[model samples]
Target: MFLGIDVGGTKMQFAVGVGEDVFVLNKVPTPSRYAELLQVVEEHCSEAEKRFEYAGKIVEMGIGIPGTFTKERVVWVPNIPCLEGQDLAGDLRTRLGAGVYLGNDAQLALAGEVWKGAGRENSNAILMSIGTGIGGAIMIGDRIVKGRRGAAGALGWLNLDASVPGDKNHGYLENYASGTGIAGVGETHVPPLSTYEIVAKAKEGDSFCRKTMDRAGHLIGAGLASVASVLDTEIIILSGGLSEAIETFKKPMLDSFIEYAAPGVEQVPIVKSELGNLSGAYGAVRLAMVRGDMWIG
Candidate 1:
């Protein structure tokens, strides 16, 4: 059996699978501290084993974290600060007594898509996840590009304005195209609205909300165009929370993407994630399946 875990900012998802079928799944709120996070995982594992009647069966595990890491430690995790500078993989392996594999959540999502989702038929594709923040991965053939330091897929930091300095907010593509960015679109209200609220308002025919979403789509498209100019991948798969609002942004995103894309690159297809939010978990399964033979980082 293979166990997959996705550690996100607000939630942690766990899945157990044998071959291509996932037999068990669970979700829990993410704890703020590393110790609590570990405990939560352990508890979930125990519960899943009991619930699935897989007690005593040996299993390999794969974990996906939303940040960059080295072979021995996680160096940066913006949303989950407690994990920064920690040896998460080592700790998990020691506590769980299982062979553990670690990978970036975005890259893992791409792996899942490649294995059984939208990217299954495409050898070269890009998975761009636009949620609280934007994360991306580039797949060339069967392998994912994991730069020397495993930060190759941190596409959110891509500069959208050369003159502005890259920071947590403002200059990067993420600052303008992510869920947080979408929420910040019209901040004039006394109490700023959330991304969902903005989408709801737009659906109700609010012109300002509609225009804001349109702008976000255009900016996202421009960023994708930049990526295409460089990688020229066969397809672009959009994932994350905001992707649910694809109808509100697809046209503008595609328009700007094509307008800025170089020559034939514009013809590349852009599609929604077929795996939805489960891509990371599925990718974790893939990671566990190939644990000893491949280097995820």
Candidate 2:
């Protein structure tokens, strides 16, 4: 069996898969401290083994982390501060006594999509997760493009408006396009609400919420356009919790994307993820299987 873990800013998800079947799945709030995070992972692993009747069985493990690493040590983790500069994979392997592999969460999600989701039919694609922050990955042919420092798909940092240089908030695209961005925009009219609540209100005909979502869509589209202009991606897949509200803003997003995209590039298809929120976990499982040489595709 292959074990996959997706460590996000707000939550952590775990899954166990054999072949095409997922036998175990769980989620929990992501702990902020390193110790608590490790404890939670251990507990989850124990629970999975108990529930799946795989007690004491050695399994290949893959972890999807929301950060970048160098030499198997975490170098940058903007969302999870406690993980910075830590040897996460080594520590996990030591504790679990099993093979542990690590990968960028966005890249893993892209991999999952390529393996069984939206990108299964596309040769070149981009996957963007627009949640608390915007995370993205690029895939060319059969491999993910990890640039020199494995920071190739940091799409959140893409600068869309040059005039608003040096904004005191987060990065340009992240500040305006992510779930947090949507909530931030919604706060102008009333108290802050979760991304889901904002979308719900918008669906109920709240004009302010609708406008906020619309603005977010345009910004997201602009970011996608910037990427498409450079890579000429064959397809763009949107994931994360915010993607659940794609119906609200997809049209305006496509419109803005077409407005900014290079000639002929606007024709590229933009779609929602088929794997939904489990893309990262699925990708992590695929990575584990690949590293273990148990599956080839």
Candidate 3:
């Protein structure tokens, strides 16, 4: 049996999968402290074992994180400031007593897509998650192409602005197009509704909400075009809470993407994700099944 754990910026999801069937083991709000996170994972592991027929110590466990895991299982999680360079897998193995694998959350989502979601069609694909921040993962022929230093799909470095040559991000793209970005847009307006609420309002014909999502969509398309021009992937799959408003945002986004895409890269399709929010956990579970797949392993 395998256990999958997805640790997001906001919450943590757990699941147990045997063969083709999976059981949503549990979901819990992620806490900040390292010890608290360990505690939660331990509880979930026990619960999953109880609910499922797997009795022996968790044979393999996979953790989908927001960033890369390097030597000694150190996790370089950026958004979750406190986890930077911590020995995540080693710690988990010690606490849980078995094999533990660590991987990027976005990469796991891509794996989920390829496994049973929208990305099943093509061998080469790009999966981007637009939410509190934007994340990307690249897969070629069923393999995630983690570049030297494991930063190939790190799109935050895609310079949208040439003026600030070294700027990690623009206040707009990082603070407007993302879930955190759109929420930052009206931080002082309408009581600071969440991106989910914003999309809900836009669906109800709220003009301001619609405009906010449209602009964000356009921004996202422009970025995606840049990626397409370079990689020329078969398709780009988008997911996250923001994608819920695809109806109101797709047109402008498509237009902007076409406007920015270079010549001859005409048919790179943009589509919604099929994995929903479980991609991360599913991907994590898949990662644990692979042997000798770790960095510096």
Candidate 3: where are CA atoms >4 Å away? Answer: 54-57, 78-82, 148-151, 164-166, 169-172, 187-201, 204-209, 292-297
lDDT of 3 at 149: 48
Off by over 4 Å in 1: 50-56, 168-171, 189-193, 292-297
> Which of candidates 1 and 3 is the stronger one according to lDDT?
1
Q: What is the full ranking by TM-score, best candidate first? A: 1, 2, 3
**Tens digit per residue, CA lDDT, model 3, 19-128:** 77666766788888888888888888887777775554568888888776663464466667557767877888898886887777887788778777888868788887
- Tens-place lDDT per residue, model 2, 126-229, is 99888788889998776777655556688888898888876554689998888877777766765767678879988897887788888988989988998998
lDDT of 3: 0.76
- Per-candidate TM-scores read 0.89, 0.85, 0.84
Worst 10 residues of 1 by lDDT: 288-297
Candidate 3 accuracy as TM-score: 0.84
Candidate with more favorable, higher TM-score: 2 or 3: 2
